[model samples]
Target: MDAAMFSIGNSSSASDNETVVIASNEDLYSYAERVVAAVICSIICIFGSIGNSLVIIAVLLSRKLHTPPNVFVVSLATADLLTSLFLIWDVVALLSSDGWPLPNAKWLCTMTSFVIFVCIGTSLSNLAAISLNRYILITKPYRTYQRIYSPVNIGLMVIFTWICPNLLSLLLSLTKIVGFGYNRKYFICCHFGQQPEDELLFILSDVLLIFIVLVVVVLSYIFVLKHVRQHFKGKRRREVQGIVMQASTSGNDTERQDRQRSTTAENSISQPDPSGQPIRRRENYKDLQVTKNLLLVVVVFFVCFLPYSFLIIFPRSDSFHLYAILLALMNSCVNPVIYARRHPHFKIVLSAMIKCQYQNIPEPTGIAKRFFSRGINPIL
Candidate 1:
């Protein structure tokens, strides 16, 4: 009987030990998840903040980049900068024992959600504004776009971009029409813990807004493309006419001599401007290139934001939702890359800054140089 009782006690002790081991394993898994999430957020914050800051500084320092359209770019960069800064809180919240660092503070969640919404909304609005600006400038250059997008007007637009989203978000939060709080599953504070009806309403409203903005952007690009095609066709036609005119008149010796002299004069006129200055054609080309770069920005914004937006509409699993949010955050890091690649002036400036070789660079030689020489400091 003593042996049997001892055996029973041993069995009970073993079962308790197994239970403790299982609980420990679960805790370890949770801890690992938090660490991984925190690490990812940290990387995103560092990269995004650096890239966006560089863009803002480059634009400020480069007079050439201070054009009307670039005002929107600056605003976008600011929004992205704020986004990167705000993501630090996400990291902190994730690392906390309760997933939300300030779990007892409801206002922190509300404020965080509000700020995130505003930044994201402003980013999207700025992209849409850029697309519309390009469309008007390219497709309807003869219209009142110049007057409409004057510096003061542009400033107002920028102000509106910042204000409208924030005001709306604040109103929604204050009224309790929508809700925001910590989501334990996603380990982030955002639009969560709402009534089912209210959540649906919020999602639908967000979807509608996104749809409208996307439609505007898409249509603007479509018209811009058509205009560009027509412009090239007309230019080609004029070139062909000039060649035919020269050929037809070439048969008469006297006329050919006169025409040759005229052609020589024209060629001289077409040569690079005095002092290696950019010509009107080169200026126009630079503008077109910048427009293309901005269009790329719009495209990148769309691609990055779409996953999160769709997940909101479709209501995905928690893991998928987390990934979607991460993808959206990555947009802040990518815009600078797009700028560096597409904007020649930006690339030159960035390279100069990186290498600390900001002096005594030769003047730009041709149309290519037009991209680098315009009002941008050649050195430093």
Candidate 2:
């Protein structure tokens, strides 16, 4: 979403009579602005690249982490990594040139714009996919959804995430449906044109797509929350029923009644027999932890990308736009940090990878228990 600034040369006959302009305080301020932008972009590029690379490596190295949902995570990391790499070129260009250095290099602009569009699109799409994956896992924890999210299907989803964006962008670029050029205002190479219709179409399409993604992500999380609440409510009801049954069947067989109550409590928490036609499967703690982590990721994604998405629709001042872009890009690096902080298994694996020491790491206390005790269970 970065725009490259380009200078539009005048072709007017009056240009010959016009006097040259000198650098003023405004010029100094503009220069300082570009310098600051270059520094920030450079830092984001370096850190984002390293952090996403670690996520990819960590997932690949850990055998236990190889799940259907993690496949989407790997896809997400790959997209972010590509974005960080592309931003490196943008950073270099910003530092070296005042305006578009290669005004005539339409092909270069188109190619770069295509790559950036694809990467950003893929990243957003993968995030949506992750949210949907969690929603299905949390709300429909049965053999049916399990089969649906099989390795083959997950692999296809990963492929779709990468290909769909590139194909759509390439189609637009190759057909000249969207113009690519240096936006002098934004000081970055991106989709731009003199045609009002084309510009409107580009802006509308980008905004609409972003809105759709936000909608899907928000709805998925909402459904997950509802499902978790229902699950816990049902579990509580069963526990109460078991207690009543024990109380009624009293005194002489008190020991047996207590044993039955404990059994019922345990069964209430355990997954139902897959062979039996139950409405819901047992709530797996491991799966719940994974869902919780993914939920945090979705929240982070929303928080980080919201401003940038807003700016795209309602671009205000240059400073706001710059900070928005930086915040959005910072999300690329933040995933690894989120993984390290919120996911114990990810932390252990990451630690082992960094230390090159394959020692046993103890699992932390149940995240579900902590969440339930706090009167908030996002996952059962």
Residues 58-129 of candidate 1 have per-residue lDDT tens digits of: 665556566777889889999998888878888877777644567577567656666777888898789888
Model 2: residue 183 alpha-carbon error in angstroms: 3.2
Task: Estimate, for each residue in 72-190, the C-alpha lDDT of model 2 and write its tens digit.
Answer: 88888888887777776566556544455766765565566567778878987898999898887777646877888987888888888888887877676665556555444545555
Worst ten in a row by lDDT for model 2:
2-11
What's model 1's lDDT at 164?
Answer: 84
Candidate 2 — what's its lDDT?
0.66
Compare the candidates by lDDT and give the number of the best one.
1
State the C-alpha lDDT per candidate: 0.68, 0.66
Instruction: Output the number of the TM-score-best candidate.
Output: 2
Looking at model 1, residue 193 earns an lDDT score of 25
